[model samples]
Target chain A: MPKLSYLKALHRALRDEMDRDESVFVLGEDMNFALTNTTSGFLDRFGADRVLEMPLSEQGFTNFATGAALAGRRPVVEFQIPFLLLLVFEQITNQANKFLLMSGGQRSVPVTYLMPAGGHRPGWGAQHSDQPYSLFAHMGVKTVLPATPTDAYGLLTTAIRDDDPVVVIGPLACLGVREDVDHADLVPVPLGKGRIHRAGTDVTLVATGHLVHEAIAVADDLAGDISVEVFDPRTVYPFDWDLLAESVGRTGRLVVADDTNRFSGLGAEVLATAAEELPLRVPPKRVSRPDGAVVGAAPELDAVLQPTREQIADAVRSVLKESGWGA
Target chain B: MSVLDEVPATEADSAVPDSAALYRTIRFIRRFEERAVELVKAGEIRSGIHPCIGQEAVAAGAVATLDADDVVLSSHRGHGHLLAKGCDPARLMAELAGRATGIDRGRGGSFHPSDFSANVFNATGTVGHGAAIAAGIGWAAATAGSPRVVLSFFGDGAVSQGALLEGFNLAALWRLPVVYVCENNGYATTLPAGAAIAGTVVGRGEAFGIPSSSVDGQDAETVYAAVREAVVRARSGGGPSLLEMRTYRYHGHHTFELKTRLRYREQSEVDSWLGRDPLLIQAARVAEDERARVDAEVEARLDEVVRFAVASPYPDPATATDHLHADGLRPRPGSAR
Candidate 1:
């Protein structure tokens, strides 16, 4: 079994897809130079025609990818900075996302907006730190936030091949996480499917993106008193609520860990939907950054702004206590 | 059926538009816009259209030079572009009327209709954004080893958008087969070009090292010659070119202006542009018998077009949000389920 890090998984998925489909081309700033290491050595392998190096024109290139996709060429656009997504949100959300509907399904834009260092890298201030998968998801764009190496490779591979626009966010924090992998186990993960990493009869901890790792660790630490189930809904939009309902029904408790703003974030949507539709013994709990959070430059500030494992552990016990069950 | 004059196989593949066929195209767009305006007033067209009434030659002349298979990216005032590019008049009228028989199946109204048969990929209402999409299509065609050139049409206002200039840079850098036509129609909504643009229009294209020229948009032949040269250059892998068409619209920016009664341009300035009307300019070039025949035929054809548009059924409400995703994922209902 080879140890596959999350970064390698993302890089490998892009390399493999381009190899599989000649129509799959990459365009972004400094792609030939491999600024994000995702397209490292791509220029030499695919030649200058396939790997396009764009100028520092985000909006132009974003819509350019949309146009290319309209002409039957699959474009995987990689943006190094997460905030650049905000800059070109209109191109993705308004243009590429709506083309299929607006064109009456006559044309489909199969462009993959790949954000390599999504959400808060170390020392990068407020401008660069944002996990905006919720933004794309809200606009009905298929959004993928993978928590593990295998899931990263699977989900991203699926995104590039999709006939519509998809946003694949490789969370900066999950890049270093590694796992032993059997190459046969590496496969395309279907969107809107939840993976139950650990099963239990007690509370169900539904975590998103990089926070899924923190959630699993918290479940292990509280193994003595509470039986916790850790579930990761890798793709946020078109969420697998049926899978979520079954887990919550078994546990009779629900808690969400998310790496976004407290208000209207992924965690809020999970709890809101569960509270409105799913069976729950007690009120659902959510651990997320404060409302409209702006992560500062310092590491301590980043940690303070991020959801922690201790917070997830406490939320699980508190939900049980609220239910008047043994905490 | 297509009411507009579609060139014959011989003329379609010709390097330039035949004078008579070109006159019919300009005349067709002129009559089509007039009928659309009437439909807007009759309450059939819920969203009043942007009438490119006087700027017909730019669409007719420019589109005449290209092959029927080449792609086009249009703007908000795009009926002229679409009609000249060979979209069925009845379907286009139905699209304006928000009918199920529209080119976009009523998903996109007059503002965003895309006719794949005509090679007119959907119009972007956002100003200047179509340029980038055109460049992208151009790049894709070149990459696929296809000789298809892309034509992007926009107004004077689009020149200032950062994305449009960036689009220029990309097309010039990659030597993509795209022709950008700027209809400098004196004003954008209400602001005059003198107040809106900083430097000259051709300078924007020249700054990117693209072959840039300004043409008299009122004469159909002048526009045809300029676009034909650009198309020839693009088809031969000579990169992109920009042509600034000095044209003016006879009507207000949109039909909404009919109610607002806004007074921006002087009456004298309005009368001056009306004198050089592109339709009349081309009408003179054709034989009197031919011109009168096209006129009678176009008016009679538009009557049926209007009937088809108003009589077409509206789409079912159940499918209002259909075709949103390729994978067929539905959003949760708005009300409590």
Candidate 2:
């Protein structure tokens, strides 16, 4: 067994894919120096041709990756900050994503947009902190946010091999998380599959990215009184709605903890889907950042804006109490 | 049948830049556009097109320099580019009519039609974004050890876009084999270039250290000579080059201007540009008998193109989600169940 940190898993996935496929290359700013740590040591191994260091031109390089994909090369574009995704939204969604349909399936843009540190990090103020995976999911782009090291390795490997545009977000908080793993067991994870961390019958707690760890910890703390089910959807766009419905059907309650803004967030969509389609004994609840949340530079302000384990536990208890099944 | 497969071996391998061929190409595009406008009036082609009536030489002459294997990224006014690149007229017309037999299967209408079979990768409606994509394609070709040079065509309006400039920087920095062609038709939709652009079109290229020059876009030979030199440079690994083709459009930006009178340019200005029509300019170089014969041939070809486009069938509504994903993954049915 080997201990694999989340960041190390992403680095390994990229390095292995490049080794496996010559067409797979990395293009981004500061990739030569590996400023984000995921692309570290790639420049020396792949050389300047395969590991390209682009200028500070987000939109240009984004569309450039699309062009490369059109020419039968798979490109993985790494962005340093999460909001950089917002800068090239039109390039990805409008141009790259629509090429397959616009060309009448004549072309497939196999470009992966990887955000190394996706969510809020203390001291990195408003401009850099944003979790925009929901935006990509809404635009029908395959969006993945991995919660664990093994899942990160699997999803990123799958994203690089996919024939369409995919956005892989490595939440800032999950980068340091590590787990013991058998190296031989590492494999590609299929998209749209939800992983159940812990099974219970009283309530279903749906979490994404970093929040999955929080949900699991809260479930352990409340084991004496309540029975909680923790579900982590690795990919958000082609969401595992079937698995979600099945879980909620058994638990009879739903609560979502997401890091995205409260308005039009993934949590909102999850709660809405559960209420409209799934059979639930009580109303579903969501714990998310306030509407139009701008994380400040201070640690306390950032902490207050982020969804905490206490918030998840509180939401879970409220749902249980509403269903009149509280211990 | 694929249009590229039907192309003559010699025609696909090399473009001789002869007078008759250039004249026929210009005339074919000019009449094709006129007939397309007529189709628009008849309510067959849904939207009005950006007619490249006077700017045919830029498309005909520039495309004449490239081999069939080379790629082209075109702009909104791209019918001439497609036709000159050897795209079948019937399929192009079908696409404009939104028929199932279109080059893009009617998925992309007038603004965005792509025919990968012809090596015309795509014609984006977005003004300037294609340049970056073109650079990427060039970079990919270089990496693959292919001797393919990508030509990116855009309006003078695209010179000011930050993305296009960034593309220039990347292409020059990496020495990617791409030719950036700017057709300065003096106006972008309605705004004049003088008002929109800051320094100059060629200056934008020079600032990026890319070898650039301005050429008379009205004359087919001049445009051919300039673009041919750029293409040669790119193929020889000399890096990217920019050519500013000073041209004009005889008609309004779109066919809707036929009914709505948005007075931006003087009628005299229009008359002056119409006088420099690429079709007539090339028509003068050929004998009267040859010109008349070419005119008759173009007319007959366009007649067939129109008939074929109108006779094609529209796609079924049940299959509207087709081609949305490469893996044929359709969206969930209307109901949640």
The top-ranked prediction according to TM-score is 1
Model 2, range A1-327, lDDT digits (tens) per residue?
A: 789999999999999999999999999998878999998899889999999899999999998998999999999999999999999999999998898888877898999999989998888888888999889988889889999999999999999999989999999999999999998867999988899999999999999999999999999999979899999998998899999989999999999999999999999999888878988888889999899899888888788899999999999999988944332
Off by over 4 Å in 2: A324-327, B1-16, B333-337
Docking class of 1: high
**lDDT by residue for model 2 (B1-337), tens:** 3222333456424535667777888888888999999999999999778889999999988988888789999999999899988888899999999999999888877888888978999887778999999999999999888999999999999998999998898899989999999999999989999999988899999998999999999999788888888998899899999999999998899999999978999999989988888888888889999889878877877888999999999978887888877777666666776
Q: Give i-RMS (Å) per prediction.
A: 0.7, 1.0
lDDT of 1 at A292: 91
| Candidate 1 TM-score, true structure as reference | 0.98
In candidate 1, how many Å is residue B109 off?
0.9
Error of 2 at A149 (Å): 0.6
Residue pairs in clash, model 2: none
Candidate 1 accuracy as lDDT: 0.90
> lDDT by residue for model 1 over B240-277, one digit each (tens)?
99999999998999999999989998999989999998
